[model samples]
Target: MDASTFFILVLIGSAAACLLGSLTGLGGGAVLTPLLVLVLGVDLRYAIGASLIAVIATSSGATATFAREGFTNIRVGVVLEVATVAGALLGAYIAGLVDKSTIAIVFSIALFWSAWATLRGAPPVVPTGESDALATRLRLASSHPTHGGSQPYGVVRVPSGLALMFGAGVLSALAGIGSGVIKVLAMDRVMRLPFKVSTTTSNFMIGVTAAASVGVYLHRGQIEPRICAPVVLGGLVGSMVGARLLPRLRTRWLRVIFAIVVIGAGVEMCRKAIVGGF
Candidate 1:
């Protein structure tokens, strides 16, 4: 395909992916990376670079709405970001040392893991109003607005949550994703935050995490403006729309869609790896 045609397709695909990513807190890169590599025939490194740009755009676009709505836990996001940033730097360095086939295999595995965890879903978390001592000292516990009123919640397992955020960052840089799936899991399941709070906080954190890792790709000469420009523009648009719709939207169906898309992409990527198409 010609450059213009490819650009148009990328624009459309990125818009759609970012829309879903905003709603699910998975970030645009989760879906955009696979689409670029598997459908558009972009190289893995270039695709990852573009996806990181998209993730940053998506987070910036969506986070404003989430933060305004009082769903994002700023303290939690900021605290977790330290570990995420550290891990992102290490992971970006490792990505340079690995071959395309190895990266592809690891990316596919991450996708599969994301799908499985999303599908299985977490059990309902009933806030017990018992905040961990560490969480209290760190000021991690906060409240989110709900239909009835402001509902107070407590944070738990601070150490475990930080550890998981570190892993999420490593995967995010390695796979060119926001690693929001793992971030949400750490906050919602391990940290015991409300689902809405976890997702919005994860969204708030994505841009910082992507920013930390993107420098590595830029220095490596993997980022192409021709590819990244349209992706960022499209993702910004989609994420804004999704953010506007989030307050009233029920996310049960969104989770299913996220899982299906992730699984399909993982399967296709696995096939490509097996066929030596990396």
Candidate 2:
């Protein structure tokens, strides 16, 4: 394809990816990387670099709105980011050593996991009405706006949540996705934060996590501005639109549809890994 045609197609595909990602709280990198690799025949490393850029863009755009609405808990997000940043740097180093097929296989596995989580739906947040000592020390406890007005929530299992955030960062760098699936799991399941807080806080941290590895990718010359430009632009626009539509839509239905798509993407990635050996 010519340069212009390739850019246009990438823009369109990235937009769709971001829209679905935002709606499902998954983030665009999950879909964008696969689309570039399987369809556009891009190198895996380059695709990852571009996807990270889109992740940062989508996260920044969506987080601004979510934060303003009081969905994001800034304190919790900041504390978790310390772990994620360290993990992201390590994951980026590992990515450079791994073969393309190995990355593809890992990416496929992550996709499957993400799909399963989406299908299962966000677990109910059962606040123990008691907070972890660590959480209290960090002041991670917070509240978010609900239909009933501001609802308070307590943070629990800070140590476990931080450990999971580390894993989420590793996955984010390894697969070139936001790894919001794992982030939400850590917050909602382990920390006992409300679902909305978990999702928004995940979004709040994604950009920083991706940014941590982005510098490494850039230094390695993986980021191609030509590809990244359209991906970022489209992702930002699409995610903003998706954020606006989030409150109106039934998330369960969106999750079902998005999960099906994620499963298909996973199958494709695995097929590629099998057919094209390391």
Candidate 3:
């Protein structure tokens, strides 16, 4: 394909990826990563680098709406970020030697968990375990809007939340996708935040988490400017369209579709991991 044609196809694909990602909360990385890898013949390592740019765009673009509406718990997001960022750095370093297939295997497990968490229910209201010193000082606990309406919410295992953030960072950095699902799972299931709060707050942190490692990816020669340019540009346009169309769609079916996609990725990862080659 000529340069112009490749660029155009990438643009179309990225826009669709962003749109799908925004609608489902999977982030564009999950969608775009596979496309760049399986379809466009991009390397998984660099595919991840390009996808990180899109994940950043996805989080930044979507979080504003949630924050402006007074739904996001910025304090919680910021606190959790400390752990996630730390984890991301470590994950990135570890990824340099590990095969991409292995990362995908871990990601597959994370993906299954994310879908289950979303389908099951929201986080609990009561504070379960003791809060960390920093969590107490930060006052990260609060309420969130629900499908029914506004309701009280709380962050359960403050330290565990931090730990989960770290784990998410590791997975995302390794797999080249924003590990928002895992992050939310840590906060919601482990820390026991409400579903809406967990989802929104996780969204708030994704960009920062991805951004933490973007420079590393760039410096390590993982990011190709030609490929990244189209992925980033396409993802942004797709996200705008998805956000606009979100409210009109039947989300239950969409959730199922999203889960299916994740499963597909997992299967691909499993295949590669088991075979030791893609």
In the range 148-243, model 1's lDDT, one tens digit per residue, is 999999999989999999998999999898888889889988899998888878888889999999999999998999899889889999999988
TM-score, candidate number 3: 0.88
lDDT measured at residue 18 in model 3 versus the true structure, 0 to 100: 79
Cα lDDT computed for each candidate against the true fold: 0.87, 0.88, 0.77
Best-performing candidate as measured by lDDT: 2
Where model 1 places Cα greater than 4 Å from the true spot, the runs are 248-258
Model 2 steric clash pairs: none
Put down candidate 3 lDDT per residue, 160-223, tens digits, no spaces: 7788789889888877778887887777677776566777788888888889888788889998
lDDT of predicted model 1:
0.87
Clash count of each predicted structure = 0, 0, 5
Q: Which candidate comes out best when scored by TM-score?
A: 2
Give model 1 RMSD, 1 decimal.
1.7
lDDT of 2 by residue, 78-196 (tens): 99999999999999999999998899989989889988888887576576556878889888777777779878888989989999999989989988989999999999888898887
